[model samples]
Structures are given as C-alpha cells and as structure tokens.
Target: MDDRGGAPAPPEKISAVPVRHPGRWVAAAVLLVLAAMLVHSLLTNPNWKWAVVGQYLFAPRVLHGMLLTIELTALAMAIGIVGGVIVAVMRLSPNPIVSGIAWLYAWFFRGTPVLVQVIFWSFIAALYPYLSLGIPFGTEFVYFDSNKLVPIFVGVVLGFGLNEVAYMSEIVRAGILSVDRGQTEAAEALGMTRTKIMRRIILPQAMRVIIPPTGNETISMLKTTSLAAVVAVGELFTTVQLIYGSNYQQIPLLVVASLWYLVLTSVLSVFQYYIERHYARGTVPLRARGFRFGRAQGGLS
Candidate 1:
C-alpha cells in the first residue's frame, strides 16, 4: 500500500469504434461521376485539336520560352527569400520605426495589383529618366538611363521579385511567430547575441513552418510567370500565345502550354515533398511512400 493513497479507481470504459461515414462514399461517387463527365467532354471535343497540341509541344521556340520562365521563377524566388528574411526581421524589431517601415513596404506592395506593378516598372523611365547613385545633395557618382537599365526582362523580374518579397515577408513573419518565445529567452540566458540567436536557434525551428507555404508560393510563382507576356518577355505562356496568334489554333496551343506547366509543377511538388521530409526529423514523418502498383500480400499469415 502507498503512504497517502491506495490504488486509483479503474478508468472509465469507452468504445473504440470509429464513427461510420457512409456519406463519404456517396460524395466520392458523385465526384467520380463529375470527373468522368469532364474526361468524356475533353475526349469528345473536336476543337481541342490534340494533333496541334502534340505538334508544337516540342518546338524550339516553346522550349526556349520554358527555359526563360524557369529562369524568371528562380531569380524572383531568390530575391523574395533573401529580402523576406531581412524584412521579417525588421517586422519583429522592438523599435516602432523599423517595424513601421517594414509594414509600409509590405502594405503598399501587397495592396497593389502585381500587373500594375509590372506595367509601372516597364515604364519607370517616365517617372525617373535616369537612376543615379550618389551622396544625397552632394556628388553624383554614377548615372544610368532607366529605359536601358530596366528592359522588359529586367522589369518583369523586378516586378515578380518585389511582389514576392511582400508576400514572402508575411510567410516568414508567421513562421517566426510560430516558434516558441521561450527559445529566445533561453538563448539570451546563454549570452547569445541576437544575430547568433536568430541564425542558430530561431530560423532553423521556423523553417518547418516556413517551408510548406514557400513550396506553395513557388508553384504559384511558376504560374504567375504567365503574366510576363504582358511585358513582351518570352516566357512559356507568351510562346504559346505567339504560336496561337500566328496559326489561329488558340485552344490547342494553350493546351500544350497547360500540359508543360503541369509537368513542371508535378516535378516541383515531388521536390517539395522530399524537402519537407528532410526537415521533418523528430516530428511524425510524412507519408513519403507514393502509390505502388502490382503487388499485394494476399494469404493470411
């Protein structure tokens, strides 16, 4: 017998059976029917012009366009990532001025439409004919023609990257907030500087929260590259648009572009899954095993 008490009362018995969900099967059946209808329509539709889709998919111009889209996405995402980190840190600053500046930047960029921003950058020369690097109210050290320095490709990249920076900053700020505040206090107790604390203690933990959304943003950015067509930059969608414009087979050309975008996104999704898995150490591992076909252990052991 224990000194203060005897054995505790037996725990209450509860049934472990899961709730039946027959409506789920009904919903799945309805969804399958809808999907079948969609597939049927696509297959039977003559205007799709599958032959044309097949013909231009491998065209040299199309391939070059896709390469440029890839480049734009990569460069823009890089800027967003690095700038987001700086802005997020600023957002977390104790000083109101620093945080206010960050807020202003995030607010203005995010509030405006990305297309407007793109057009603005494309014609920035109208606002500032020359970009000068010099001491304020002192010597002008360098000057470059805005029109030359900010061409179509440069404008598009700057547009995508700047827009991404605002969104990414919020993503990063949320990630930073997800971390336990106690960790910061603990690092401080250990005499860690703010920079070291962030580098070693905070950012690593925040990455788990940050990565999933970043993957989503990357996929969105891939699609958003289509907007570059407005600026005369020859990204994938632009190439498809030009082909269709020339041949007047708009549907099929668009379909080819959609197929290529699908392929690229699928590849990026696989990469994102592996990256998530890598960072998921010590947490419950995600189901990395994709669907496998052709095998089943049938006999009862």
Candidate 2:
C-alpha cells in the first residue's frame, strides 16, 4: 500500500533475461567437424577393405565360427550363473569353514588372469596324465587320458566358467546384501528355513540387483571367448585368425570379427536394457526408466 493511502503502486515487472555461453556453440561446432572428418576417413580409407569385410562377413566358415562363439558363451555363462549362486550362498554361510572355502575359491580364481587359467587348463595333461575316479588312494577305478577327458573346447569352457564363477559370486553376494535385513528377519519370523528363505523370499527380490551386472558379464564373456583361440578352439576369433593366416587378409578378417562382436554386444545391450526396465518397474520414475544409452531429457542445467 502507498503511504498516500490512495492505491498501492503496481508491482515492478521483472525483465528476466537468460544467460548464454558462446563457448558451448564453439565446442559443439568443433565436435561436429571432428565427427564429419572421422566419417570421411572411414569411408575413404581403402586399406580398411570394407569390400573384403563384406565378402567374409557371412561366409560359411565365419558363420560357423560365430555359432561356436555363441555356444561357448552360453555354456560358460550357464555354468557361471548356476555355480555363482551356489558359491554366493556358501560365501554368506553362517559356518566359518564354508565361507572360508568359498572365499578361497574366489580369491584363487579371481586373483589370476583368465588367460593364464585358459593356458593352464589347456596344458593340464602335462601335470596329470590320467584322471581317475575311485575311492581315494585305497581303491583304484577306471582312469581316462587327461587329454581325452578334457578336450580343448572343454578346457576353455572350464577356464572361462571357473573364472566367471568367482566374479559372478561377488555380483550375487552384493545383490543379496542389497536386500534389506528386515526382510530376512521377517522371513525367519515366519519360521522359514534359511534355504527356503533364500530361494523363495530373498533371491527373487535380490534379482533386481543381480540382473544388470549379470548381463554385462554375459556380454564380456562373449568377447573373452576369443581367448580360447590360443588353444585352437574354432570360435569366431580363432576362425578369423585361421582365415587371415592363410589368405594374409589380416585387417579385413579382423574387421569382420569386430563387426560380429559389435553386433552381438549391441543385441545383448538391448536385452540388458529391457531386463533392467523390468526390474525397475515400480521403483524408477516413469520417464527416467529408459535404455542405458538414451539421452537425457530437458534443457542443460
């Protein structure tokens, strides 16, 4: 109100103006130029041998190699996930001996490079020439040649699978720990056994945390299968190497392998996105629950 008591002066209008940063425009322009230059280089470079890449992309040998790679990934991950859950449970066991054993297993496997494990397994026959199943040292039973019992592919799977078990166990343990302690208490109050509580009550809820990283591990395993090539496993990278070795088209063959890996990883990523969204239901905000690679909405903060 005015001191004159006639009428209050109208409120002053705010002439708000937005601040701008010209540097952002310059940075964006520079990035666009760099991106265009990269694209031009990829298209114009004859040494890339895009035409050769196309020729072998779907060749019979390449396709076979791709199938083998997929099989190895699936088999290894299957072993990993199942063994992981068991080890995770053991790791969290109330018994000190059990938990200690589990910890030792993880320590040994995770402590070593996967490549070393692969090489060791491939040459395991050198150390143990025969694998025997019997009643310890007291009684002898049938024995099989180590090389026959553990084929090259089998050895590779064992290496990848055992190493993965160590990692997946940690992932599972973290997920299990993420579940509220109150939930376990409530289940126990209901007279549920530990195993029952884990299987029915805890694990289902922990899956929300478990799935995302598991998917990432699966994708990583796909690439790690390339390490199997050292033992002459006919997986994708091995097959590519064999082809390049014979034809001397190393770069082109390498490109083909990279393309397949990219495609497989992309597919896995999409699956991971959907699985994450599934788990995120009723948890994440509607608009924010999207593909991991999705751009953020709204203006710059």
Candidate 3:
C-alpha cells in the first residue's frame, strides 16, 4: 500500500449468518398433533376388532387375489407402455395422416370414461356375435365367437391398456419435448440420421423426465385394476366382494383388500424412491453428513 501510494484498508470482519427455518417448527407441531390424535383414537375406541384384522390379514384366498392383482397390473402396464411409445412416435411423425390417426386414437380413448370402455368391451358380443379378422374385400382370415374372444379378463386388459396408452402417449411426448432443441440440432450437425439421433441421443436423455411419470402411471394402473371388479374379473376387490357376499363379513373382507392395496402401493413407492434416487445422481449436489436446526447448528439443549 505504501509503495503504491494508496491508503491501507482496515482488517475485514467475518460474521456467521443465522439460517432461518421456521418450517421445521411447524412440522414438529404437526407431528405432535397427529400423535395426540392417534393416541386419543386408540384409547377411546372400543369396537376396533384386532382379532378379526389379524385373522383376515394373511388369508390364503386374499393372497391369491393380491397375486392376481399384481399379474394384471404388470400385464396391463407392459401393453400400455409399448402401445404408448408407438402412439407417441406416430403423433410426432412428419406425415399428417400418421399424426392425425395417432391424434384421433388418443382423443377417443382419453375422452371416454374407462368404466364405460370396460362395460362396452364386456358386452361386445351384443354388437357382433362373432369376431372376425380379414383383409378388406377378402375372405375372413380368422373367426371366433365374440363370447370367447372378449372374456372378462380380456375386457379389463383392453379397457385399462387402451386408456392408459392415451395418457402415457402424452407423458412420452412431454418427455421427448423436454429435451432441448439444441441437442437435436447438434446431433444433426454431427451427421447423425433422425433415427440415430432419437435412438442414441434423444431417448437416453429424455429418460430422466420419462421415468418418474411412468412409475406414477404404473402405480396408478395397479390401483385402477380394481375397476375390473365391475366386469367380474375376480381380481382383489372382486374376490373380497365374493367372500363378503357369501359370508357377510363385509368390513373384514374389505379391510383385507384395502390392506393389500396399501402393501402394493407401499412397495411401489419404495421402488419409485430408489429409481428417483438413481436418476437424481449427478443432477443434484450432495451435502455434508450433519444436522442443522433452525437458526443454529444444533437443536435446543
């Protein structure tokens, strides 16, 4: 400073910033209130049937129904995902006819209620007593009785899967669109063909956006399979209904179905968390392993 002929600066001061986190207190209060309510309910309720709950929770038939629910969900979701991808690609195709057809497919399915679709499929025999597939202006390639062709299980799959395709098409399209335009342009600049760009560059990147929604759709589809009960598909809820209809143990049977659904949702949620964490890697920063309370490094002593 003396050599440069400038005034010497005073020593700078360091001050610690107090972090504000009023939300933590709010959360703690909310948890305490919920605990109190739970305790009060447990202490006051006398009609809670713990014995019935325990007896029905692990029944063999209930386990079978749960297994059926899982199978139905898995099959429907597989069909939906494959069909949805096709529809999404068709919708994005350059040809007006292809895009328009895809648009109409999505529009009709998404616009109609799924329950109506299921009912219609179940009663398809009323419209056409026989099922036939053939080339236009040609003899029938295959024929079968409509009753045999569209059973309750098939009806449920067609209804749920077709409707899911429409919803999942939108999800896939959104994921594809979320990729930056520049990425596509850059791929093209590198002499990549459109197919190569989509396969190699676009889809891989778009997966980050695609996976969460797909997981959510899968979970929703699992619950949505309950609607198959209306068609007498003998899935979880339908099985419970059958039991209760015969035995008149409505509450306990219903509870069993509800518990199975809860278990299914819990398992799916855990899977979703792990998948989200896997994708979140490299996108989010990791923090030091420590706890900090509101406006302090430690909680109240």
Top of the candidates by TM-score: 2
Clashing pairs in 1: none
Compose the digit string of candidate 3's lDDT tens values, residues 182-251: 9999999999998899889888777788889999999998998889898788789888899879977787
Local accuracy of candidate 2 as per-residue lDDT tens digits, 138-216: 7768889999999788899999999999999999999999999999999999999998999998898898999999999
Q: Which portions of model 2 miss their true places by more than 4 Å?
A: 1-11, 286-301
Q: What lDDT does candidate 1 reach at residue 120? A: 90
TM-score of each: 0.85, 0.91, 0.82
Q: Which is the winner by TM-score between candidate 1 and candidate 2?
A: 2
lDDT for model 1: 0.91
Residue-level lDDT of model 1, residues 110-188, one tens digit each, is 9999999988988899999999999999999999999999987888889989999999999999999999999999999
> How many angstroms is residue 230 displaced in model 3 relative to the true structure, after the best TM-score fit?
0.7
Q: Rank the candidates by lDDT, best first.
A: 2, 1, 3
Alpha-carbon RMSD, candidate 2: 5.2
Report lDDT (CA) for all predictions: 0.91, 0.93, 0.85
RMSD of each: 7.6, 5.2, 6.5
Error of 3 at 54 (Å): 1.3
Q: Is candidate 1 or candidate 3 better by TM-score?
A: 1
